[model samples]
Target: MTKRAKNTPRWTAGMACGLAIGIGLGIVLDNIVLGIALALCLGVALAYALPSKDTQA
Candidate 1:
């Protein structure tokens, strides 16, 4: 089998958490549009900012 850069799926843990929290925050803040939009950005940034088990090929 060929070695891959990342063994994990595309959705990182941080992204998942961000989206989950985003939904809750969106409901609480009553701004789902903004919440989800911001969450996407937060997710991406957090995914990179936070460390994970994925490694280079």
Candidate 2:
């Protein structure tokens, strides 16, 4: 029997939320460069914030 990895719903949700917020802010602020930068930063930050699921036995 093989073990399956756990689903990362929180990470997905965080990324979606971050992207939406970044785009929305960029549009509101009327700056494409700022929006892209914000999105990238947010994406990286979110990715880093996600918990690692790798197990060592």
Candidate 3:
């Protein structure tokens, strides 16, 4: 049996959420540039705000 990684999942979730939101916003707003910019900014901000694996342990 193998133990699953922890922080990796959380990070993945964050990225997925960011991507979904960004894509949705971009589609609804009809602006590729704005969507990409917002997605990147939000993604980075969220990633920074979340606790890292080292910190959790």
Among these predictions, the greatest lDDT belongs to 1
Candidate RMSDs in Å, in order, are 5.6, 6.6, 7.6
Cand. 1 Cα-lDDT: 0.73
* Per-residue lDDT of model 1, residues 10-45, tens digit only: 457768877887777888999999789878877777
Candidate 3 worst ten-residue window by lDDT: 5-14
lDDT of each: 0.73, 0.70, 0.72
Each candidate's TM vs. the true structure?
Answer: 0.63, 0.56, 0.62
Candidate of highest TM-score: 1
Candidate 3 global TM-score: 0.62
User: Can you tell me which runs of candidate 3 are displaced by over 4 Å?
Assistant: 1-14
Model 1 residue pairs with clashes: none
Q: What is the lDDT of residue 17 in candidate 3?
A: 67
* Model 3 agreement with the true structure over 1-57: per-residue lDDT tens digits: 998655433456566667778878998999988888888777766766677767585
lDDT-better candidate, 1 vs 2? 1
Task: Give lDDT: candidate 3, residue 44.
Answer: 68
